[model samples]
Target chain A: MQSNQELEGFRVELRDWLEANCPAEMRGGEASESSICWGGKNFEFASDAQRDWMERAASKGYTVPTWPVEYGGAGLNRAQEKIFKEEMDRIGARSPLDSFGIWMLGPALLHFGSHEQKLHYLPPIARGEIRWCQGYSEPGAGSDLASVQTKGEDKGDHWLVNGQKIWTSYADKADWIFALIRTDREAPKHKGISFLLINMEDAGVETRPIKLISGASVFCETFFTDVKVPKHQIVGTENRGWDVAKYLLTHEREMISGGGQGLSGGRALGAVLNESLGEGQEMETTLRADAMRCEVDALATGLTLERYKDQAEAGTGAGDASAMLKYMGTELNKQRHELLMAAGGSDALEWDGPLGNRPADWLRTKANSIEGGTSEVMLSIVSRRVLGLGA
Target chain B: MANLVMTEDETMLADAARGFLDKSAPVKAFRDLRDAGKTHDAKMWKEMADMGWAGVLVPESAGGSDMGHAAAGVLAHEMGKTLVVSPFLSTAVIAATALRNVSDARAEKALAAIATGDVTYALAVDETSKFNPEATSMVATREGNGFRLSGKKTFVVDGALADRLLVLAKTDDGLTLFDIPADRAGITRNAQNMIDARDSARIDFDNVEATGEDVLGQVDSAMSVLKPAIEAGQAALAAEMAGLSAGAFGMTVAYLKERKQFGTVIGNFQALQHRAAHLWCEIEVTASAIVNAGRLLDEDPDNAIMAVSLAKARATSTAQLAVQEGVQMHGGIGMTDAYDIGFYMKRARVGAEWLGDYGYHANQVAKHRGF
Candidate 1:
């Protein structure tokens, strides 16, 4: 660990570096979902600035700064990583790349995957060369993920996988998937599962985009029919995939909780309200109060995240408290969007044009609680695992 | 005052305060104090003063240990858990904030006296007005070099026992703050019986005399100091409310585990478990808000208002829900006066109303947002 003075110096240098490197266009307001870069085989650049930003960030390993430098990361410690984030936040730098592989699969591979797997898989993720999607929730298993029946039959050197995964976010665009598959049908529900890595382009693999109310198809139903996955593609042991699944779920929840801080890096609610209400808008006192309260809660949620990160760095990792964070974060996100919608008034109801996007984004926040885990499921975990309140 | 992490010193301070309160002034002690017809435990107040809690916000140069509002918040939180009936919030938090915000020789003298447990102070801001601080209608007329104050201040926490009163009054310029001795001539105090049985009074000022030395900060521009000082107080109250809610929630959970019904403990029921889980989440979120408010007070005084209001509003709502559910979950026992859970509900009610209710604070947040 470096001294505080050394870290301070690093921060100054890092701030200057980011300012010099990050394109001016990428340092403005929040980046819309469509503008986000999910590096994959078929990824398209939204703009030159976006492509340039991703290339610059990936070259320096800032996309996955905490990972080992050998795995295309900056290899910064947790404290330095935090400083890096703060500096980026100070300049409102848009995330150069958004990938599940970075948030979920990358961490799992680092912690539980073999050295061979880490070397093979993590660098591509760090470089944003391959985007990944999760294959956790099956049609049969939503909250009861242990009951997943996505089966993978053992065959000498490969596994034949078959089953459908519901709510697979961005599956259509993903290059690969880290999925939970039942390798042993006779074993107990949780014991027979295996975490498998399969290319989305593999034979008999298909994704059907699920159109949402917001008129977006970000979610897809991913199906695997006799899909061949090499034995080495199996993460962890065949019958012990539930462990990897559980670990990955923690990361997934953490990722969803990041939405609590606003996925778009949108302007502050107060700022938005000020613009919408204008100088003489007759905004109701109750509405204003609700907006302010929600804004405060959102800021507090950010602070809470920092506290949990600090605690995690200090060795008291959030553990099941990640459920608490996920629950609070998603709920706060919903509250923020709700207030935004209210501030927009009749204009928020438009279904097209720039003004209509607020309503769409507000509707999008609805998925926050449902995805990762339903708010109810998160609450149950918090009560039983975090608060020790169980029946 | 949102802190992502507490320093080792702060953690130790919080832990020690909690331990002391648990041992010395638990929920049962509140009952004992009431049975003894005492609004506050003077001995405990002195003990807290000895612990340097009274001077937590006072700078070291003013004959006190200079701790940040975050530390004071920790102490306030611990005190709330045990419902430690004292003037600590009024005297230590509000008054100390006023003295610190406006650093004058007279204020420093008062700070010194407060540090040694020799004197106590309360902000007599609320009149027959609404919750707004700017609604103060007390008149302060200039009389030669001095001033004559006359009006009524209602719902002044610990006002009856305070040595000095930070009175908000209307001057020729605008709203002002006057620090006057509580025992000054022509001043009368009457206890107002509250649901929580906490020390509060309605003070009547009948042409009370004050000089230039009595003015805190500027005459009409006291908002510069009073705004942040009152915000600090609000943040402290939010911390206390968070503690009270957590304490109540814990007690309710314990009761659910112990008190069995229909062949097993009722805690086994999914319905109660779900409600308990919801309460736990709410309380945890509110805790985050309180920490944020305290951090803003210590670090970003200029931007502390919104965070303070958020903390107060969230904690107020959370504690209210917890206290109400606490009584309901405990069945018939929770409703009885003999039970400690009932006390939490009463204390939560008073605490919620004292600083500002959820609606009031939330409104302030909205107003700050330019509504």
Candidate 2:
């Protein structure tokens, strides 16, 4: 571990730099989809301040601070990255960019992609020049992700793809997609799958937004009809994409759990409820008690996450333990929003106005348990893998 | 306030405690002691004191290892897993904490005696069913150079066997704490037959006399010493409950793997597996809260209210879940006296109401969180 003095010095320097570079407009704002910069080739910035903030942060590789400099990152260690995040949070600095490429695909590529492939893709992701969407869940496969039937037939120089992928979050807006394709039909289900990168702009590709209970089209049903993909675009072994896909799923689970923290941001639910009630007003005891329990559980979840990080630093990785985090965090997040809705009361029933996207947010949290992996499947995985329970 | 993970020395101490407890005082020992109708075993407590656990919070000058609260929690947690019947929490944690706050010669001697296992103490509070020490109705009227204590303290844990007692009594100023012998004149000790089969008493202090030397800290500010002691005990009890949960959950999981239903192992059923997994997740989260509580009490005891209450609340709820699931999954065997799962259920029930129940702790946390 580095000395506290050294970390303190670095934090001071980082704080000064953030103060000088971060736009005032970029700080102290709720992280909503409209204000976020996805930064694809066709993405228009919400404002000049948003564009400037992302470019300045990306130039320093703060978007993916822990990745190596050669891979378009600041080359920070874990402690430094934590310090960077803490400093960013102190000033209420909004994340310059949000995309699947940075969270999910970048980690998978860093571990399994070829050097040439990393150089070609990682820089664009770090700089937010490209947006990526995951295509692991097909129309036929959700929990049984390895059983995806998206066909990728080899044709000497290229591969022909034909299948449909559902729940491709932000797929209509993504520039590229990382998909699991079935290349070997006669082999075992898991053995036949391959992870391939596809350009969304390519011919015979289509995307249609799926309306959700949240009244927003955050996900799309992406279709690949006779699409051609270069043979070299495959990640890891051709028929062993399941390994890379599984590894990526771990990152996705961590990210989903982290999404709870993003929303929580250490804001007290009691205070939120008090504000909703418009001052000098007392929240009902039952609702207040429920909110406190949720807050306490959220705090516990946060501590659990920190403990796991410390354990991983001590050379004991939380392998299957991440499942517990996802299940609890998502559940707690939903509970928090549910309390928020109840706190809002009749005013909460309104679609818009003073309540501010909370009704939509509460409904959106429903997807947290269903997406990535359902809570039921997560429990099954924990039982089988972590506990080693046998038939 | 402190590191979420234990230090190297703390982890080593925990390993040693686990090894010794598993070997010497496994669940069988608890069962045997119960069969003999003994709520506590002085011989086993002497062995623990010989191993330096009785002085975990005491200073080296007072014949202790001074291993801190986290280390004490580690030992207590291990004892909890085996349902070790002892006075470590009441004597080592609470009594030591109370003694450490005041540096009087008697308190110092008491601390040294506690470290040596020559004496044990229990706090005499809770006049009613609940544990609101501030609501103490026990009055001590000034009589010459001493005071006469008159009150009944119900649910005085470890009071049955403790050599000394820390009694809370209302004085003209406010609430005052008196440290005196349990065998003092006019003090009647009638031990209760708790469902958990633990050493608890409902004592009637009929004008029990206490001198100025017996007063710990200032007269009216007894909370200065008593509050920390109680909080220390609460955190350790929380740690114990966390371990008890893990122990019960472990037994349940093992049973699930072995028990067969409909020609298949019961563990293979999704119904049972999900419940087991959900319980495991609850235990894991509660473990972190317990760890944080220990850390906070060690580093920032003044500001540890939120963390300590959360730990106790989470541990109480999770332990309840573990024992309930344990019994439900174990079928008829769980209900039989021959099985050890019932012991955990009883202990968890006792722990939930010990320092403070779930609602009490949650109220504390809610206040800290500005609810």
Candidate 3:
């Protein structure tokens, strides 16, 4: 563990910086996907306060605090990055920016992209100047993602890109798409793919929204019809995009797994129960027990996540142990939302219910087990890879 | 303050304990003792005390190492891994916690003797079945300057074998805890053959006389001392159960790798593999809860109720999963009496019911969570 004595001075400075710079409107901000600041050409902030907060955070390199200072970051270590987040959370200040560029593409670029590519791509992501979307999942390749049919023929100068990508989150608002293209059709499914960075402004690119059961259009069906992409824009070695994709998938999985970092903000199950059931009113014993069980399991999951991080900090990486975190964390998240709806009762069914986003949030959690990597796939990975139970 | 991951010192201590337990006492040793109709071995107890295990929570002034609760938890966790049946929890953890709270000369003497491997203590708390110390009806009526104790304490683990007993009794003021000899007049210990093959008994205290020196802390303040004692025992018990889960999981995984059916290992089958993986995740998560509980107990004892309850409840459920899956995955061999896995199943059952069952701790969690 990092010594507190070393972090004491850093923490005080961070706390003061957050308190002074973060606007009152941004503190305890709206916890909704619609209010998120996903910076793009057409991106408009929900309020002036939101815009100012993002600019201030970007200037201080708090958006991607661990990135190198040359790439618009604070150059903080993992320990300092943790302190930065904690100080921000202490003031109830919401994250200044959220996008696929900062989370998924930036890590892939940092690892697999060339030094020039990192210089060109990473700064914009860290500054939230451009929003990005992942173009990996297809109707044909959900769990078997390696069998991607998006062909990218070897056109000497600039390759031709064509195919469809499903579940491209915020595709309409995104300025670019990080996609996988088939460069060698004759090669094996996993061997032929190549990671491509394509601008959404390219003529053939189109995005159509797909409404979810929660009555939200957070995802889109993105089509790449003979779109032109410079050969130099490819990440990593060509026809080896599977390596980059897998590396990026781990980040995507951890982020969505919600191990102590779920989208559910603030209020706990018991507090929700008391709010709806009334403070003095006696609740159903079984429901109450269910709420308590959820709380206990959530506590266990959070500690497990922290332990793994500590293990990583101690130079013993989480390794195969991380495979199971996605399974446990996502399952627990789904369980929490299911109990949340149960606590909300008949009132939860109302469109504009007193339980703000409780109904929509409940439906959204259903996707948690399906998106990123399904819970079943995570279990299989744990069993076959970690446990060595494969035939 | 809550460091779920062990420090360098704690890791070394665990490594040492693992080496000692594997050599001196393993699963085979527990099986042998069960076959011999014995709950514990006195020579083994002496060796443990000689190694300063009995003094893990005891003070240096009383000739103990006084390694604190985290070190004691480390020892208990290693003991549980090998199914080492002893009075480590009852004597070193529970009784020592109660005795150390009182500054009397006799209490100090008892602790010093405990450090020397000359004394073992058991807690007598339960009345009928459930662990509700607040409802303890064991009367401690004033008789002149002394008190007459009359009550029956059931599920008294190590009661029949311990050198002394810590009894929770109701007094005119409210509830009082007494530290007295088990062989005292009017105290009868009827040994009950438990499923775990451990030394548990129903002790009857019929007008047992006790002086002022026998009382721990003061009259009507049993909760003051007993609360911390029980919480300590509960956290240590949680660690033991977590260790037990890992032990059972290790055995099951080994069996999975070796046992074959249909021209391949059964572990290769997706059905069993997923179940094993799920169990592993449960064990890992529950281990964090156990570690956090010990941390909170050592660093922040006053507000450790929620953490302790969460740890106990999570450990109890996780142990159930581990043993149940351990047997199911082991198939027919797991059910046979000749196998060691059955012993783990029985021991897990005992741990579940010892301090508090799933429902009991769940309620505690709900209460603190304000539901």
Candidate 4:
């Protein structure tokens, strides 16, 4: 509700606050695959300080700026939120919260959560008190996402959840999970699904870490043995969970696509390539052209993201168009990483410290085209929805 | 700044062009034109002109859409989709842009007529295979009241069919541009058949007469005018290349999905899927670059020159890769003359080599960066 002048004034004040509070040691530091953190998860050194900062910012609704002020968000317009991000990025200020709750569940809840549900959940998420993980992709269902067989049986007062989810990122570390379960056995595949929110600490919940090619155990296989979730935790109408899942997938794709842009604090692709390739490697004329081409694409994709963000703020964001952006962005990011790995050559294959880590990181990026939705699935969406090709 | 982003109006125009080309300019038409050794489809050209495509980039004051380069590029992209062979690029975009940029009233009127489908023009710039406009090899000297143009211009695009020719020549002062009528005395045209079956001509000008009025812009500053035109031309060609690459990639994917090999559709193979996915990514990236260049051209003409160079260089490489991979992925069927994939690949090669090859544009970009 603030005027443009008021927003500008707030930006200046926020910039000064960030400059004073952000730790100098945290600035310009390399991000590890394990921890892109200035402080640990326990908030050891500045635990109270970080918590206070988070609480103050959340109280002002700055943590989720575009969310309503009544719902514990800053209620800032898109331009103001952009300025907030710019200032925070400029000062190297780390986010108080970095979890699926902040990125995925919060947006879905805002759209589909009941008033009581929003009141109960939005505050805790905004305050960085809860970490959420996704439970959508099952062992049997990967790219054919709607085929999830996780069952949520009605048990009168509460629903009993029983099934397993694979590729559940941070499931062990998460405080809660938003899952898609089959609620109607006789109905069609997509129509039978339901979206439910469950506590990770519930009696029958379990998680086992899944080690990846990157050697990082970032994801897990989550199991629910008669896990009980309260009836109120179901998002939207029962058996319409597929709709909520689809909506959440859109947000997840947006997050993944946007993730490519802010990696390692807005470093230019050309700078990254030059740094990795070294001074006199004799970049073939063809390779130089390819690099410039990639750079142009990154810039264009970034601009497209900005344009779409503006649309989202205006409440007119195209749902399927986000898929197009995500599809293009993740693939481009993978290509960029591929180029970096190739430029690094044998050095990229080293796996000891940070130098040893590049190869693993590069290997992990191969999931970019597979995760969220397979690149093939994204194209099908584009051809059918955006271009109206297959009808 | 002109809105280089495609608006609804522009998208509608592009869709209309696509529909027309799909229904009218199919693969058979392209083959017929090639077999007949024709440069363009006469009926299809008239239809496109009737749709006001020839004037898509001209100013509204000159009885054209004044839509600008971005819209023109979109139209050309659709044309590239069906491989609609014509002088649309040479007459509508290149020649018209040259005349418009010159800011001469007479030239504007001539361009207006071209937009109305009553006139057509071609650019005679390339003297050799290299992309150096400065080394024109054509000379113009002062004579009584006008000027005499003397030179041999090869690969003059649509030179045989053009009503007017915009000739780049060197004068005593410096390089200049002259608007010479095709019927001028001592102007001889030798029509040449191109590899892709496009129309081109080797023009010989033996003391052709010209006046100051026919000189576009400043007499000695043709390079300035020529530079932007070349960039615009390159950008348009890149857009076309994007379309051609997309179509070819789509056909390959379709073929892969249908063709059974080893008791399964070839598309299901992990290796082929990966390759196809990579090519799709390349096409998307190239498209993003070309679209961005077009948008930048509308916003900043100067920066657009660099963007165009970058785009064309990238597109040339990417298109070649896409077509080669597309054909290889299709196996022997892709190599057959009956298959349309070869046509797309041939068109891509012609488009890539038209303005400058990948190496030339890369060097241009490097030079711009002070390398």
Q: Considering every candidate listed, which one attains the maximal TM-score? A: 2
True contacts kept of each: 0.56, 0.68, 0.76, 0.05
* Stretches of candidate 3 exceeding 4 Å from the true structure: A1-6, A16-35, A75-93, A114-116, A259-266, A278-281
Ordered by TM-score, highest first, the candidates read: 2, 3, 1, 4
- Provide the lDDT at B117 for model 4: 71
Give a tens-digit lDDT track for model 2, residues A248-351.
88778877876753323455667667778856778998998898788778878877887887777678877888888889988988898889888888888878
lDDT of the candidates, in the order given: 0.83, 0.88, 0.85, 0.76
A127-166 in candidate 3: lDDT tens per residue? 8888899999998999888988988877788989888999
- lDDT at A66 for candidate 1? 88
- Looking at model 2, the pairs that clash are none
Candidates 2 and 4, the one with greater DockQ: 2
Model 2, residue B14: what's the lDDT? 83
Ranking by DockQ: 3, 2, 1, 4
Q: Give the TM-score of candidate 2.
A: 0.95
Tell me how many clashing residue pairs each candidate has: 9, 0, 0, 5
Who is ahead in DockQ, 3 or 4?
Answer: 3
User: Model 3, DockQ value?
Assistant: 0.67
lDDT of 4 by residue, A235-320 (tens): 99999998988888898887777665433235555555566665686665655666655555565466566656655655677588
Give the local distance difference test score of model 1: 0.83
Question: DockQ, in order, for the candidates?
Answer: 0.48, 0.64, 0.67, 0.12
